[model samples]
Target: MVALRGVTRTVRLPDDQELHILRGVDLTVNSGDHTAVVGRSGCGKSTLLNLLGLLDVPTGGELTFLGTPVQHLRDSARARLRGEAVGFVFQQFNLLPGRSALDNVMTPLLYAGGKQFWRRREIAMDILDRVGLAHRARTMPTMLSGGEQQRVAIARALVRRPRLILADEPTGALDVDTGQTVMALLDTVATESGAALITITHDVNVAALARACYRLETGVLSAAAIPTGANA
Candidate 1:
């Protein structure tokens, strides 16, 4: 559902020097595919995720989503596409401070019109149930535990039935056991929904859960071998 060829991202520093974030990165993510990207803290994984999520444009090369070229799309068009086809889960859980869990999940439907928007409450409730957060629907973010908040975030991301999920350090703030549970839930939900999942993480165990894995270094992405008996 996504493709990138020789993609590059560069930004001008305060001193007029150019900072290259991604260099000729090539990647393709098909429907129902699970891919993992592992990299150090400053190796440009976030830049790659922004490009894949349609939140930013590449400085050079090509990017397409479901066969349509996206590098030249206007900001509004790109936002529309992202709303319709992509879901995002982040380490920070990005939930609006005062919104209830159900309301948070329903936020995406405001962009999805007609039946989806009209039935957003019902749909959001169902997704909350799927993520085991039905009872917490009325709860505020501060009232919930870290794992519960993340679960709500996942529910919000999946409520739109998006074709692609971009997760960045989804389990970074959780304990080991909670992280495992969250990852398993993410995998299960993506598979059940037939959405491609691209996870950005620094954890090797997290990367092992994907069918394909790559490590980013020096602004480059290269495939990494999964050890024998790896989960993927």
Candidate 2:
């Protein structure tokens, strides 16, 4: 449901020089597609995510969402579309400091409008249950363990059943087993809902969960082969 062709992002430095972030990147993600983007730090992976999430417009090139050119959309329209169509999970968990798990999850629904807003509590509770956090629904982020916090974040992201899920370094703070479980949860949820999943990570194991993978380096994106062990 997303396409990018020759996408480029350049930032103007304080010195008045241009710094290229992404150059000539091409990508396509359809419903039910699981795509992984692997890159080292400062390789523009986050920049690409910002463009896909509609947080930033491409400096140049064609970027489209559901066949509509993103560059042509206004900030308000972009924000509206992003709220309705996309879900984001970050490595930091980014939970509200003082909100309970349930409350944090319901925050998105508050701005979602219609049934989602009216039934926010029920919807949020159901998703937390699905993520196996029903018992901790009242727990604060500080009281929960890292794995639990991440699960809560995932539940929050999925509370509204967004059509696209963007996870950036989702497993960074968890142990191997916890990381595996988190990735599995994301894959299963996306598959069941027919939503596309895009994971941005440096770990090959995390990237392995995706059906297709790409390596981003020096602002360029290219097809990546699943590692030998990843094939198993």
Candidate 3:
């Protein structure tokens, strides 16, 4: 559902020097595909994710989402498209401080229209239940454990029923066992929802769960083999 060809991102420094981030990166994500991108710090993974999520535009090359070229879209159009077709899960579990789990999940539907806005609570609750957070729907983020909070974050991302799900280091903040559980839950949900899952991680074990694995280095992305028995 998404394709990037010769994508490049560069930033201008105060000294008028240009710093290149992404260098002609090409990627393709198909419907219901599970893909993983592994990279180190300052390796341009964040820039790539921003471009893929439509939060930012590439300085060069073309990006297409769902068959529509997004390189020339206005900010408002990009925002609308992102809200309608993309779901994001962050490593920090970006939930509102005072909002309940259900309310947090309902935040995305606020941008969505029609029946979704009116029935947001029900939809959010259902997703929370799917993520095993039904009983914690009314709880605040502070009251929930790390795993529960991540589950709520997942629920929020899926509430919109996005066609593409972008998860950035989703298990980074949890313990090993908790992270495993969360990854399992994420994979199951994405498969069940038929959303293309793109996970940006630094862990090979995490990358192993994906059908396609890639490594990002020096602003370039290339396919990598999932090691034998590496699946968690």
List the candidate 1 regions with Cα displacement exceeding 4 Å.
227-232
Q: Please estimate how well model 2 matches the true structure, expressed as its whole-model Cα lDDT.
A: 0.93
Name the weakest run of 10 consecutive residues (lDDT summed) in model 3: 223-232
lDDT (10s digit) by residue, model 2, range 1-232:
9999999999999999999999999999999999999999999999999999989999999999988898999999999999989999999999998999999999999898788889999999999999999999999999999989999999988888999999999999998789888999989998988999999999888988889999999999999986433435
Instruction: Tell me each candidate's TM-score.
Output: 0.96, 0.97, 0.97
RMSD for all candidates, in order, please.
1.7, 1.3, 1.2
lDDT tens readout by residue for model 3, 109-147:
988889998998899899999999899888999999999
- Candidate 2 — worst ten consecutive residues by lDDT sum? 223-232
What number of clashing residue pairs does each candidate have, in the order they appear?
Answer: 0, 0, 0
Candidate 1 has a TM-score of: 0.96
Q: Is candidate 1 or candidate 3 better by TM-score?
A: 3
lDDT of 2 at 23: 96
Residues forming the 10-long window of minimal summed lDDT in candidate 1: 223-232
